[model samples]
Target: MIYADDSGHPASGLVLYGWIEFSPDHWAPVLKSWLDLRKRLWRDYGIPVTQELHATQFVNGRGRISQRIPPRFIHRGVEYWKDFGREVAVQCLETLRSTEGLTVGAVWRRRSPAELAQTKSEAYSALIRRFEDELAEADSLALVFMDGDGSDSSYRKSHRSLKLAQRRVIEDAIHLDSRSSQLIQMADLVAWCANSSVDRHPGNHFASEWYSTFLAERDPCRSPREI
Candidate 1:
């Protein structure tokens, strides 16, 4: 199966969609490793594994980690922990690189929501085409998983129709909560990092590294046209 997630607000200047594709054979090992990484976050950094692997929250130091900081250092502490959190994300991504039977892809564009919506069909066509290409190379009929809450119904219907029309390329598209799956979380990480790469204001140097790392190994599915 392929787990997918998106990063950046549609209204933002940059938006990214990322996915991790792996076969049934490798799913267990990858998932187990991810779970182990969560444990390591607690053991190594005292960060709870139960906390969602949310990029924005980690960057902003909001949610669970906020309560753990002392009032005196809350501001600086959050910044410090945010860096640590980003490091953990980078480490997790690096580990996933070594796993067999996995390929990652991202499609990003620098355009506002209005511009994208103006040509949504064309964008979907390019993305679906690139996904099918990956499936073809893998020789696998996979289900594409993403968060239903993040997907618009009309867009989902249109995407479904497109995939179904292609015949055996994708088995189906499944939507589940990102919190429910570690793989989905990983997808989120990729999306988040990729967005950071292009976000000049964020000042995250690792974002470009992470973005290049994922794209280096696979053919990225870009918008306006497949690449």
Candidate 2:
């Protein structure tokens, strides 16, 4: 299975997370659709693929120097982002709805008073439990990814637990001579890409989010160079 997730620190709002899942066969078309939208956006704006653009700047701060654009631009941009996400989500859902040869799951965590009160590790532990439950009944190969806030040192503290969970989930697969599951931390790449925002080619928010889930599900076996 293929999994993707996104993370965001909403201005004056909660930290948020979202994820989607799909099987190998469904990956091509869905990825194509997402790419198509990106291409259209680039073409319309004469944006270059090698560069990126920040969402805030794309709307020109809504006619203000430092403030966000007016509601019209904000609304349009948000709608575009949401529509891009929904299209991929719907495709994934369609493939997994029957659960015939594949099972998929996604989760979202929004920071709340209770969550903030807990230690960062504690909050991550809770999120891990939800992830574990999602794949508990699966018999096929499993892959998991998660988007993380690179700034949260406390969150990274949960890496130990995440590692243990990965081992447990794929132990059976290993015993049967199958590939073991893997986990990855994709925040660095996401952060780099986000910071690289150029003109017109808005930041790849979907890729940033997907990196998390991808890192979470990759095989653990790797060489030092690979890391």
Candidate 3:
């Protein structure tokens, strides 16, 4: 199955879509490793192992990030979130690099204000083609799990638009609550860091190297595609 997520916004000049793929035989072991990472996060920050690690919110110091470790306690500054966010996110991603059964892929594109919607559509379609090619090469079928509750029609259409004889994604995307799925949350991290690699920002300058540093080893693209 593939656990997918996206980052960036229409207001931003760059947007990204990312997913982590693994086979059914390895699913249990893969999930165990992911949960193991959450355990480590809980140990380090006193954050609940089950808490949704929404990359944007978690990094911005929003939500109950931890119980014993206060976000502000990490640093005494208005931007403590950004500082500690870089630290925790980097640690988690580096750890994820060793997850045994996953392959990563992502595609991003830069767009002007007027072109954001159209460019996003094109980029996602390009990623869908990549997914199709991979499944075809392996002669396998896979389900796509995205971070939402099945409300996104664009993704459904992307899968459905594939030539009927050629489409490999099983039915429509199976959306789930990201809060309950650690895999999807990791995909969220993938998306965010992929965006930072291209669209550098003052707030997330610390993530500038995260994509090349952590995720590149697993992605055949080496760097994410610039569609």
Candidate 4:
């Protein structure tokens, strides 16, 4: 099932992560149509990148709404950020929807920790629990995608505890039927794109908090190469 999430961090406050879900078979066409419209909006308005087009700035003259992205954009954005996860949900959804035989399901993530003692791994466990609770009805395949910590030494060190927590959660969850469950690290792909600025405008800023928390959750002891 397709799942997505976003992160946000404003100043000194704790990091926040948001998530949402979609039924891929049911929503794929709708999402594709919406993305087509987004592309056209960019083409029509000369907006080269998704990030440059702010949700508030997109307008629909036919609908007579000002400062509102088209209904589809609004709908998808709202769905993706149902719990404040961040923009990565959008990216993740877009990527997964492109494949066949995939369906999206409930999305979730831990937002912030009141104490530094709460590791990133622990926060991830909370996220997984939320997902499990939400999707208890179906025994469908589940794939979790998280943006990894960036390539900064200090940030990596800061995230050590969180990383350990994530590892623990994976270990705990691994006992489930291996054929039905899989966990992947999409951080490398994310990091490569972000660092290279391939899609800089649509970079992780839309879900900055998720990105920051990812940084804060790094396995401090692991090298960037290892991550």
Candidate 5:
């Protein structure tokens, strides 16, 4: 199965859409580790388990995390937590690496004015092509779970087209809330690291190093393909 997510603004430098796949044997153990991490985050760090670990939110110290810090230390604390979140994400990716049947695939496109004026077809195309390539290489059928609630008509339309074309490789593209899956959250981190690496964002201290971790475990569709 594959859990997918996207990072970066379409109007910005580069938008990355990617997925991480796990074989049946490795899925359960990785999931258990993720679940255990979630529990520890709640118990040790006092982060609520339900607060989704989106890379941007954690890095920027927005959302529920703001409530957890004192105003005087908010600025410095956010920076620390941002690094901490990066560490957590790195650990999550490493956990996936410790298993077999794990694959990471992504597609990225630099957004132009014209592309931004329309739908995010390029982003969808990047993910679809990489996913198809991986499935063909593995010669296995799988289902895709993407981060969304099926609310975006444009995305739905693109997904339909992609699915129709690659029915032999993919079983379905199911829209889901990103908050609900740890695997999807890891995909979010991968995309986030890709974006930070491309843009050289100031807050991206760990992205460069973490990228090597990605390469170490990346599958056949190894690196993020440029569109």
Candidate 6:
């Protein structure tokens, strides 16, 4: 199974779509590890286990989404919280690295300010094609679960239009709300970090090397494939 998510704007230097692949045999342990991490995050950081870990918001200290910041911080002090948020994001990425039985993959396409509106659609389509090729080479089949509650016609069209002789991707992506799906949240983190490695957000101090720092070991490809 695959859990996917996307990050970056078409007008940005690159638009990224990425996924974490897991086999049936390792699914149980993968879920177990994430749940365990959530439990620890809640116990140690006052972060609610049920909270959706949106990487960008969480890193920049925007949402105050944590159920409560630990009392020691003196009313969630701005400078302190800002730095703490980066710590939490790093820890989350570390969890992804320590967990086994998952492989990360992403495809990104660069677009300039004048690019068409469909740039992201084209990049996502490229990702689907890569997934199909990987599955075919392995002689396996897989299902894609992406972060969203509503249907995406563009993604649906990508799968429907695949040119492979034997389509190994089951169908159009099975959409899931990231709020309720731990794996999709992880995918969100993966895509966000991967994009940051390529295009540093002005305010994101940790963006420059996070993909290389935390996720490189788990991702044999080491970096996103630029299409």
Top candidate by lDDT = 6
Candidate 5: list runs displaced more than 4 Å: 66-80, 117-119, 162-166, 169-172, 219-222
Better candidate number, 3 or 6, judged by TM-score: 6
User: Rank order by TM-score, top first?
Assistant: 6, 3, 5, 1, 2, 4
Using all chains and alpha carbons, the TM-scores for the candidates as numbered come to 0.77, 0.41, 0.90, 0.36, 0.77, 0.92
Candidate 2, which ten residues in sequence have the lowest lDDT sum? 174-183
lDDT per residue for candidate 6 within 1-227, as digits (tens), equals 99999887656546788778899899999989889989988988878888999887888777575666766555545445666677788888888899989888777888774663477778878888887888889999999999886466888888889765678999779999998999999999899888877776686545778888888888869887788
User: Cα RMSD (Å) per model?
Assistant: 4.0, 13.4, 2.4, 15.0, 3.8, 2.0
Residue 36, model 3: lDDT of 83
Which predicted model would earn the best TM-score? 6
What digit string (tens of lDDT, one per residue) describes model 2 on residues 1-227?
Answer: 43333333333223322233456686565455434544544454333333323222232222111122223334534634343333333332232233333222222233454554243345345555554555665644454444433454544454444556354233211111101111111122222222222111344443333323433232121100100
The Cα local distance difference test for each model comes to 0.63, 0.34, 0.80, 0.32, 0.64, 0.81
The window of 10 residues in a row where model 6 has the poorest summed lDDT is 71-80
Off by over 4 Å in 1: 66-79, 116-122, 137-139, 163-165, 169-172, 213-215, 218-227
Q: Candidate 1 at residue 14, lDDT?
A: 53
Better of 4 and 6 by lDDT: 6
Off by over 4 Å in 4: 10-13, 49-120, 149-227
Residue runs of model 2 more than 4 Å from their true location after superposition: 1-13, 51-120, 147-159, 162-227
**Native-vs-model 2 lDDT?**
0.34
lDDT of 3 by residue, 127-184 (tens): 7887788789989998889888877677778888888888888888889898898889
lDDT of 6 at 27: 92
